[model samples]
Target chain A: MRTIKLTLNGTSVSREIEDNRLLVEFLREDMKLTGTKESCGVGVCGACTVLLDGTPISACLALAVHADGRAVTTIEGIADGDRLHPLQESFLRHGGFQCGICTPGQILAAKALLDANPHPTRAEIQHWMMGNLCRCTGYYKIIESIAAAAGAE
Target chain B: MVPFTYLEPASLDEALALLAEHGEDAKLIAGGTGLVNLMKQRLVRPDFVIGLRAIRALAGISEKDGLRIGALATIQSLEVSELVRRHAPLLAEACGHVATVRVRSMATLGGAMAHGDPNLDTPPALIAMDGQIVARTRRGERTIPVDRFFTGYFGTVLERDEIVTELLIPKQPAGSGTAFLKFLPATQDDYATVSVATRIALGADGTIREARVALGAAAMVPVRARMVEAALSGKASDEKTLGDAAPLVVDAIDPIADFRGSAEYKREMAVVHVRRALVEAAAKAKEAR
Candidate 1:
């Protein structure tokens, strides 16, 4: 076991986690921050995407111990109290999701993209969000949502 | 994942000491993109998992005599690095092609080399550029040419107590041009059906001064197409010359039949892609000249 202190969302938290515990498990099981989903245990799918030090990474492939002394942002951290983040609002406004299993990850991944490039083009949005799979939306709506979010910003 | 005591070493010396102490019982974890998946699959069950992220010294890209890339530098960082793009754009292009942005953010270049996956895009680029793997043990350090770094599938010559410290890529010749082509018939992120990286340098006389050809996903180990390189050296930088040399690549690669392609199909694709890469590289070389 190891004690890892990290900035989650905006608040700092310390926890004693198993050495083998993945970042996804730490967020969902221990912290009850189930906003990050783990659909593909491998790194191929971005369902478990979370921002580590302001960069998106596969939580399932990242160990909790690696989060030590770093900042991690998840989907739960996206909203501002009652007010939803612009990306979240844009997703809703554009009908970005269908089944919604990939919504959280999609939002977080898009959040990272906008944070890096506030005004990404349609091609840029497609390239960045390609890893976050949405079986229902066929990706056009997701692209629309992200582009709308970028424009709104 | 099997339970293991995680060790975080803050310094390279400490990490080397830990490796020496644990020997075969310990496994080093870098970006965790590769090692973590192996652990989850129960392919590796190390008693002690050494975390290398804490060693801040082993991170960053710097240009000395050549480009010196620290092992801990993330693929994303390398892809965006101005120095990398300016000096070795083929490497930057290869780094950008890996998996996705998320994987690139977490996967380290050193970890990629140590993982020794034959299908990875970086190895061929490294080999074509004459990159060297700088590995270190408690005793000393040694440089292994990237082309000879991988021993077999998922294997390298790294010792049980050794760690890859950095990758050293020498400067390309003045009239050199390089190309990295990955044939992905499936998803953009999927491993290549046949990947080719080629570097062509033209002499002032317009003959091929030197040539380097390397391939990935075309063999159990990243193949350095020495035969193809030999065929191109001193030859005219023309379509026919490149076409003749490209077929010689078939003698170097022994691809396995899988969902990506049949062995024979991969061989054919290898020849075609190598020729295309050569042609593109030759055009760039002419422009550079």
Candidate 2:
């Protein structure tokens, strides 16, 4: 076990976790922030996407200890008290999801993209969001949602 | 993942000491993008995982005499670094094509090189550009030429106590051009079926003075095609010369039949891509002239 002190969402968190505890598990179980899902246990599926120091990374592949002293932002932290983030609103407005297992990851990944490149082209959005797979919506709605959010922002 | 003891060392000296004491039973993790996956799959189960994230010394990208990229420097940093883009654009381009933006954010150059995965994009580019990997142990430091670094699939010459410190990429000489071409028939994030990296240096008369060729996913390791290099050297930098040298890589490569491509198909693609990479590099050399 190790004591990891990190900033999650907005709060500073310090916890003792097993050495092998994955970041996804730490967020879901320890912190009870279940918005970040883990579909592909490996890094490919991007369902475990979270921002580490403002850059997106696979929570499943990253150990909890690796997040020590780092800032992590997940879907749970995307909205204000009553308002949704621009991407979240856009996702809903654009009907960007169906069955919604991949929504949290998709929105968080898009958040990272927009944060870095404010007005990315459709191609840029596609390229950046390629890792975040959406099996239900067939991708067009998600792409449109991200593009809409870019314009709205 | 199986339970293990995670050790974080605040300094390089401490990390080295920990490695020296427990490296045999431990696995040094930088980004954890590679090693963590292996551990989760039960492919690798080490009792101790030495976390190098806290060691501030092992991170950054700078251009001094040449490109000195710290081992812990993320691949995303290299892709966006102006120093890397200006000096070794081939490397920058190769780094950009690695898995995904998220993976690049966490995967370190040292981890990729030390992972010794032949299917990776950076090795061929690094080999073509004459990059050397800097490794350190309690004994001291030593530089391993990128071409000779990989011993086999997922293998390197690095000792148990040794950890890769940084990668040194020599600046390209004047009148030289480099190109890294990855043939990804599947998806952009998928590994290349047969990728090629070529460097062509033009002589005063526009003849090839020196040429280097390396391929990824072509063999157990990144295969450096010396035969193709030899054939292209002293020859006219033209399509005919590229065509003649192209077949030489088939003899050099030992591709396996995988979902990406059949062995015979990859062999053929290797020739095509190698020729195209050489031609593109030669054109750049002429343009530089």
Candidate 3:
């Protein structure tokens, strides 16, 4: 076991994790940041996506130990105490999700995209979200939400 | 995916030392995009994972001696860099077509190179530029040509305890041009069907002075289409020369059957991609000149 020091959301959080602990487990279980979802416990599906050092990475694939001292932001981190992220607002307005299973990942992926590319073209938006699969097949709606958010930006 | 002791070494030296101690029982974790997926499928069962995240030196991109790409330079970084686009447009263009934006942000150059997936888009493109991979270990440091990086499918010449530290892509001549084309499998995203990277330099007389053709996903290692190059030499390359060169490349390669493509289909696509890449790259070279 190793004690890791890192920042989560807007807080400085530290903990000791098992040598084999995956970041997805630490986030969803230990930290109780259940907002971040996990479908494929592999990197293929971006359901476990989180911004690690400002990049959307799969929490399931990242070893908890590897995240030591790194800044991690889960879906739970996006909004302020009582506010919603702009992308979240656009998602709600557009009904960006169907079953909501891929919502957290979709939102987080969009947030990362908009963070790097404040105004992305429609093709760029589709190209960026290619890794995160939506089994719900609400891709057009999701793409619309992200595009609408970009237009607003 | 299984339980394993994870170590995040703060320095390259520390990481190499840990790897030296653990040897084959240990695996190096970079972005963990591909490695973790394979591990989850029980394809990789290492007892230890040496995470390279903390090694600051392995994580950024900058120019030195032509172009020095840090081992951990993310695909997103390459795709987003104006320097990469200017210095090596083929690299930027090829990386831009990687899985997706989020994946590109998480996937590192060295990790992808070290992962040694035959279908990977960047390696063949990089190899076409005659790139060199620099690796370091507790034992010592060694350099491997990008063309010789892979030994087999999902396998590399990387020895235990060694970590790739840098990639050196020679900056092209002022007027040279390059292009890459990839055929994604219709069934899955995990593999590549046929991919080609071609670079051509035109002479003052406007014929092919130099040519490099690299093909991936059609062989165990990225194949350099020597016969295609020979066929293209000093020719008035129009669509015809490119068309003729493609089949020469097709004959030169020995593709294998995989879930992504049948050997026959792969060989055919290899021809198609080579034709397209050659035509595109040759035109670009002529325009640049």
What is the overall TM-score of model 1 with all chains considered together? Answer: 0.99
Backbone clash pairs for candidate 1 read: none
lDDT of 2 by residue, B153-260 (tens): 999999999999999999787899888899999887889998999999999999999999999999999989999999887999999988888999988899999999
Instruction: Rank the models by lDDT, top first.
Output: 1, 2, 3
Q: What does candidate 3's lDDT look like per residue over B1-289, in tens digits?
A: 5777887788988898899899989998888778777777788889998888778988667777578899899898998788788788888888977776656777899999999887788998898888899999777889899988888878899998789999888878655779988888562345568888999888898888888899877887777888898888898768887787789887668888877778998898899889999999988998898
Cα RMSD to the true fold for all candidates: 0.8, 1.1, 2.0
- Candidate whose DockQ is highest: 1
* Interface Cα RMSD, each model: 0.7, 0.8, 2.5
Residues forming the 10-long window of minimal summed lDDT in candidate 3 chain A: A60-69
Estimate how well candidate 3 is docked, as a DockQ score: 0.59
Chain A TM-score of each candidate structure, as shown:
0.98, 0.98, 0.96
The list of candidate 3 runs beyond 4 A from truth reads B185-190
Candidate number with the higher TM-score (1 or 2): 1
Model 1 Cα lDDT, one tens digit per residue, A79-144: 999999999999999999998888988998999999999999898898888889888979998999
Q: Please write out the lDDT profile of model 1 over residues B64-89, one tens digit for every residue.
A: 97799999999989998999999999
- Residues A29-132, candidate 3: write the lDDT tens digits: 99998988889776777888888888888888777876777899988888877898889899999988888878898888888889988998988887778778
Q: Lowest summed-lDDT stretch of 10 residues in model 1 chain A? A: A128-137
